[model samples]
Target: MLQGKNIHFCISERPIIGEVNIMVAPGELTAIIGPNGAGKSTLFKLLSGDLTCNRGEVSYNGKPLAGFKSNQLAKVRAVMPQHSEVSFPFSSWEIVALGMINDPAAISDRDIQAVMEKLQVWHLRAQAYNMLSGGEKQRVQLARVLVQVWKKQAFPRFILLDEPVSSMDVALQHLVLDFMNELKQRNIGILMVLHDLSLVANYADQVIMMKHGEVMANGHVSEVFTNQNLESLYGYPIHVEKHHEGLGLLVHSLPIHHINQRINKAL
Candidate 1:
């Protein structure tokens, strides 16, 4: 489990990530949702140990994150960030293999192969990673993270994905989230930053909504995703509707009351 106690971040003089206590356990898919500037990405970075919080303790399974070496932390929580490449001519297979290069544990080529196969990127193994489309590249990256945390069934695992589905098309979004849920079934905890409320409604077991560096709501999917929550978070009157797959959100545009307030204030 990854947890933060009074976690906070600062950029120059501004507090970009407000302090909060969060506990993420294993075997559940957690979604971090909010509008722009809500500190979702910043919080993800802090939890991934990419950035140090000014005042807080980020512990994993009762051990201080600071106590773990870079490789040790990498082994426990595999993080997939948003950016694509510094330079990329590496084959899809090679890119994933790189994930195992600096590992503290001994992982054979067979392990890397298995991760790619699990992600269904094995056929593209020989293809140059850059040659693939945006979504394909994203999947390859995801496969890389899978390899990073890819341990035999005995050990625990956690996967952190930041906007992984943004590059994917609609159908593929479902595919990716479905795979994420399957990972949870495999006892892999997933902490993902998702922008789509509908996906959060349908797929996530829990939701953590943030705004302007503060957490607005955090609870189970059914409890956290509500019409009132959406309106408060995004300043719009959004509603969730049921679909065959699960829940779907139909945002009927911004509220007339909000528009009226803006008009009256402008007057």
Candidate 2:
């Protein structure tokens, strides 16, 4: 499991994340949702070891994150940031291969090919990553991250993604999430920052709601995704309805009149 205990971060003496606690266990899909500047990305950075926390501890598999060397940590965790840039005109295949550079295992071409196919980007393997469309590039980058953690190890591993599907179409969004589900089934923990509440309602095993750098709520989706909780989190009236198929929750904004009424009452 990946664990953050009493985590706090600050920028120039201004707090960004305060006393946040989170855990991502193997085979679980944990989604972090919040408004803009709500510290979702900052939390991700702390967990991924991209930024050191000002206080508290981040651990993976019972060991402190500070103890692991960069390459050692890469073997157990993969991170896909909100924005990725490829300066050179590297082919998609080459970009994916970069994931294995620090890996000591003798990763084969077949392994790389499988990950690309899983991401639905195998056809673009020969294309230049710099030349692909935004969605295509995102998929390729996802493929790269997947390759990093594709092989299972004796201990648990994790993937941290930040708004990975922001550029994907609806169809591709489902496809990418389906791939993530498959990874979870393989006992790979996933922690993602997403703005899509419906997706959170449908796909996440656990949800963490944040506002102003503090954790407002965290638990199973059914427990924390109540209409009242969401309304308070987003500071707007939101309705939670059952899906017709009865498999997932559907969330929608309240009517404008209802929203205005709620605001007036609050004021």
Candidate 3:
């Protein structure tokens, strides 16, 4: 339902997110993967309407993005910013419930509670948001964002996430991605900026690779995360080796002998 057509965004006449075209099917989890400063965040902002694109158009269904009012947009799309520090001291439950507040339709406290439970932040419901650990705060914020768009059913809602798992631990990282995968299975459109190549390979149905504000590759995960694209993404050598359960893991460009030598030297 979300679509961007030849979208371009520039800062001071220098393009940041170059002309891009994307269509997110109803039940798809698409990952925007690229090296640091490749404008992945910039592209997401444009799609979320936080920043206007210099050219091209982003639309939802048959309606133009620019046509939606702020509240209207809020009901349709929710964005989780990259780095948010809880400057204001509020209860965790209060922060999470804020997501459903803006929603015009009345939502029950029970529904909000359910969302919090699913995010595993129910135990933190009464804690001060500002005082929570980074990962806790991230989970609370994520729960809030989800409640904002969740509604009674998962319609007219799309989530735009920027590095939601960056602060999370390894197990939590998989939990977050697995939750996102479940969202896609439930017909939710998730557009996320993720740095984990292995996770992307396992979970992402669509992958958009960027390099220096340009699209290096965009398509199915397997097609986009090839050895060449991974190398280009990091400006170095990389190899995709067969991995667990028919998956692929990206390895460094160094030869096996050199890898062993380095490991032996370290040992």
Candidate 4:
């Protein structure tokens, strides 16, 4: 499991994250959701070892994050940031192959092809990475990260993604979430920062709600996703309804007039 205890981060005396504690177990999908400047991405950076915490401990399977070497960490955890820029003229196939650079012999062309096929990007394998559309490029980047930790190991593994589906259309968004669900079945813990509350309601096994660098709520989706909590976190009125088919919860925002009407009724 990947765990963080009392994580705190600050920049020039301005706190960006404070007393954040989280746990991600294998075979689960944990989502971080909040309004802008809520420190969701900053928390991700701290968890991914990109930034050092001011006061806290981050561990992977009981070992401190600082103790792991770069290559050693690569074997167990893969991170896909919000933006990836590839200025070089590398083909999509080559970009995905780069994921296995640490242990090239452990992965083969067949492995790469399988991942590409699964992501439905096999047809674009020969195309240039820079030439692909925004959504296609995102898929390629995801494929690269997936290839890194594809093979199961004795220890737990994880994938940290930041706004991974922001560029995709509705259909592609579901497709990507479905792929993530498949990964969870393989015992890979996934920690993603998502802006879409409805998607969070559907796919997240656990939810962490943050505002102004502190955790407002954290628990199973059903417990933490109440309409009251969402309104407090977003500073606006939100309505949540259960799906008729029992797939998941559907969330909606109340317009200003509707919010005023509700407030008048309460008064």
The predicted structure with the larger lDDT, 2 or 4, is 4
Model 3 residue 42 CA deviation (Å) reads: 0.7
The RMSD of every model to the true structure, in order and in angstroms, is: 3.8, 2.4, 3.4, 1.8
lDDT of 1 at 59: 84
In lDDT terms, how accurate is model 4? 0.92
lDDT by residue for model 2 (1-267), tens: 999999999999999998999999999999999888999999999999989999999999989999999988998899999988888889998998888888737477898998888878999989999889889888888888888887867788899999999999999998898888889876799999999899888889999999999999999998999989998998887889998998778899968888789789999
TM-score between candidate 2 and the true structure? 0.94
Colliding residue pairs in candidate 4: none
Model 1 Cα shift for residue 175 (angstroms): 1.7
lDDT of each: 0.82, 0.90, 0.82, 0.92
TM-score against truth, every candidate: 0.88, 0.94, 0.89, 0.95
Residues 66-102 of candidate 1 have per-residue lDDT tens digits of 9999877876788899876839578998898877766
Q: List the pairs of residues colliding in candidate 1.
A: none
How would you encode candidate 4's per-residue C-alpha lDDT over 75-183 as one tens digit per residue? 8899999999998999999999999998887677898899999888899999999999999999999999999988867788999999998888899899889988889
lDDT of 3 at 96: 88
User: What order do you get sorting by TM-score, best first?
Assistant: 4, 2, 3, 1
Among these predictions, the greatest TM-score belongs to 4
Best by lDDT: 4
